[model samples]
Target: MHTQPAPTPTHCPYCALQCGMQLTPDAAGEGVAVTGRADFPVNRGALCGKGQSAAAVLSRGVRLTGPLVRDPGTGRLAPATWEAALDAIAGGLARTRALHGADACGVFGGGGLTNEKAYALGKFARIVLGTSQIDYNGRFCMSSAAAAGQRAFGLDRGLPFPLEDLPRTGCVILVGSNLAETMPPALRYLTELKANGGKLIVIDPRRTRTAEQADLHLAPRPGTDLALALGMLHLLVAEGRTDEAYIRERTRGWAEARAGVMAHWPEYVERVTGVPVPRLRAAVGLFADAETAMVLTARGPEQQSKGTDTVGAWINLALATGRPGTPLSGYGCLTGQGNGQGGREHGQKADQLPGYRKLTDPAARAHVAEVWGVDPAALPGPGRSAYELLDALGGEIRSLLLMGSNPVVSAPRAAHVEERLRSLDFLAVADVVLSETAELADVVLPVTQWAEETGTVTNLEGRVLLRRRAITAPPGVRSDLEVLHELTARLSPGLEKGFPVEPEEVFDELRRASAGGPADYAGISYERLAADGGEGVFWPCPATDGPGTPRLFLDRFATEDGRARFVPVAHRAAAEEPDAEYPVYLTTGRVVAQYQSGAQTRRVDELNKAAPGPFVELHPRLAARLGVVEGDEVAVVSRRGRAVAPARVVGTIRVDTVFMPFHWGGAGRVNAVTNPALDPVSRMPEFKVCAVRVERVG
Candidate 1:
């Protein structure tokens, strides 16, 4: 009798949606085919173009199948055995540490790494290398939102309520997010909200496709989202629509927040934001009138020099409206990277310990140190944020171990980051492909990707999911767990006790380490996750017999007084403003067909054919001012650098602002001209708004 095995279920590799999918192996036994899984709640039977074509990267020809070590004789990368590659990496790291102290060695991680990998990488950097120079690419993704959430609510989860609540809400204010393009599957939530007779309001500098579906769209100047929010707050108060009872009972510090908004009158905000007062009043009416409403923000508002304060302003508005901690209403950030919520929770971030614990806190240090079998005093303190760490390379930091991120193509002031990377004395990178960053590495280790590995990832909704190993990895490749285990064994020698090669074993330790921290995952396990027909469990699952929490802050917040705090914030100009030298605002975002850095998605033939390459999206007015027509080569010049791409003139964007998708690399890379100004609290760069001048290229 001939029998066939059942297809393995997993999650998508791109974006924070983490859409559920099933991989069925080909009968010829070569590659697997991906299909949307109808059972998962997040994206029930729905997959984006990137999700449906994810399996294409799993082919042996598309990904790196072996390790490569730089040859000193020829100054080129050459194939090498795993043993040799690992040995070379160990030698490089050891040499750097011995010659320049442990602080000279650094570890850079990514948001795409699974929960297990993120945990292991953080542990390796602290315990094995004993360096405080560890951070992940996620610092650039949601650090501002995370900082604002923690400051206001004392806990940071992407969404306090799940995605299922969206359709039930009375109204939703979609701020600075293009869900229709970034996460196509999530756009249905807005459609469903409208179908249920709920109003949708979108705030952006561009009239994006997502904005077109909104009942009202407010087009503001780049970097003025804070002012727009303040204007709305001012209107809410002047109209006497503030939820006084809810504000008094459920929150604190409202008086200060109220006073701050009063100064920025609607007329004043109109001048700052270029959004009319009437439209602002209309937005305030829709929000205050709704029985249950929500505010959702994405990269647009959070990728600025004032990102933390900008996000805090939004939280203040939500608090004033009594929206959060209620059924079907709250403030949430649409986390961008896959596992972004989980990646930060587990401790790949610069300033935190496992389970989102403060690294400087004695209790946090003592608790996590006990789980890792280390002295509390032995663990390193907080390190620099992502951009700062990258900037310090070759100066204070000499060697770097980069995993899963292509920062050369993604970082703000990317050209400077590439220069810093080139300056590093020793660099090692582990990724599925030869990314732009990997091309400059001393050693490149090929690692198994999503479908080839079994691990856990936390989605935007705080739902912890298990991505099962659906297919065999290409020969000569290794899982990140295996790579971490081997490297730890080499670096620490006799002290390689905690590092485990199996994902489940590491996850068990992670649970214990996260037992009592803010983002606790103690109750979660592979068994519990695999149970319930693989629906996955939410976090704050503290006990083995208990059910995880789906909605948060229903009764009280995570604050000391059990009430959310209102952080007083005021609007400010961006780090850079348009002037005579750079007379236009430059805003960057994602295109529907391409994902971040274009590391993996660009390899897909279908995606490439659809997007082809990067282009400068300008308002028709700006195109004419530059004397350029559609498809004409144009150069966007900023103080940092310049990028040349074909012009894409359209009426969808504001006349004062120009837009570019930050996906492609090389001459078309927009990040090359982005500002690296750090937010005071969150240390996030001004990736969304910069000042630039456009000229037609000859």
Candidate 2:
């Protein structure tokens, strides 16, 4: 029943590979099939589980077909016409703006927004709502990495070189990143690195599949990553592995770095990190011995009390060893979401603008204002982060407009987010599917999914590839950009291009906006993309004449003095550690099959079966202590909330800790009981290392 088609160009929907796919759609038009194309720059003839099944997502049932409004009086949702829905939403927003000042209103968006959508949304928030309170979920994932990388190395990209270049690395130190389960496809790079005699070091509490391939796995106690990193840095310095030339001529903070590490050497670090001195010293040796190495950390390291410091400490590894700035030899944050890097690049983060420019910088504000055609002073500067944003609701926030994000279920302190949403004077949500947070919204706007939209997403490698539309959006759903245009026309500052009907035109605006910023796209034109077809190109790519810097900092860096500074770091304990009442440390992460919260992934038949529900993974000895058996429901309690789930006894985890996936809610909102403590440097709320007690839910 299968018939293949002639060569055609396409894009993959997973893990930022942006692999070129030759899609063979049934001529009669039933379903689409994908095969890896040979010429793809990131991946050649290789598609991961998520990419191979991308077509299946289009056929998945339960897409939001029509606009629906929850009747004010009846309090029940009913299919409504677009006119009626739009009018209702506009009226409510107008009323809310009149009741509360514009500053009382805020908007949130997704990192997955296309360049055009990101540009338009930033314009709309500034010119229309005129509010400084705007941010997105990317705040929780990579803000710390972005902040630290910019300050330390001058630029931040998930992979400084092509992912295929990992094989050329001499060593790979994965600190607090579970790539095997989270992004299975990206893990291919690690395997290649290992095969070439490159040592692999994994620093995590649980023994994951990634750890299985590792040369050494350091199972430090929860929230002690900074301690371990400091200890490693101390070893590197004590043994004379410090790159004296790179430190002296290039770095400005060596004296401070050396002092910080010496202040907390082996003895203090071993006590806090729970790692033996010999093993710690050995791990440092491997990092220093490798001539070329790459260091990567993810949410696990950045989602803690000292998340930013953890990332800075990881950077300390590359600086001390003289490994950064070469191909596959830099410190990079493995960004999680599909468009996580691009999301924050375009003003969705609390204190940033499009092009990765900060809000507080006058030059950045002036540059963005010129693009936006507004006074620089009109654009608000820095504001509170995600956790603080949630807590500010109802108290300082009177209105909220959410696009493509589920704050209630996704944010830490779930109970608080839910309460804050209910307390809002007006709230609206735009999504293609009915979500837990959308159900509580005053107006729910329907939108298109990935396959139904035409746009571009910058992948982890900083490669920008076109996301081609294969099929029409289901029923009356509109693109997010389209809806916002119409909505803003009725308000002040007016919409640019007035209800832009074409996606190409929207992307055009983004290019102009990027004229002079960190993520410069002035050279990337729609015509060029059309000519290039399916080839993914990295950013800072000026034109065909200019070759994109495959790897950054070959000699100098993007810092104020052209030299990379070595930032010093100190270790801090987790906000919540094991206590008498809650003696077990609970860590939350994702399973391979399920995406965040299982919102869309759970509906996919294959993905759902692969990872059905949440489970509390525990060591055999720990399960025995609670008299809990495999497949038996057990109550896991923490300071904020509790949930009962099946026990999965495994020897992979330390006896003092348990692991669970954070993609479930209702009674399973892990963040409900998770520590809401903020990282001092990153301002990211802690999602890992929460103190909890597990008991059989008899």
User: Scored by CA lDDT, what does every candidate get?
Assistant: 0.93, 0.78
lDDT of 2 at 150: 77
The residue-level lDDT of candidate 2 at 381 comes to 66
* Model 1 ranges with Cα > 4 A deviation: 1-4
Q: Clashing residue pairs in candidate 2, if any?
A: 346-354
Q: Give the winner by lDDT.
A: 1
Model 2: per-residue Cα lDDT over 349-409, one tens digit each: 7787877777888988898788777899988767677778777888787878888777777
Residue-level lDDT of model 1, residues 381-436, one tens digit each, is: 99999999999998999999999999999999999999999999999999999999
Worst 10 residues of 2 by lDDT: 492-501
TM-score of each: 0.99, 0.96
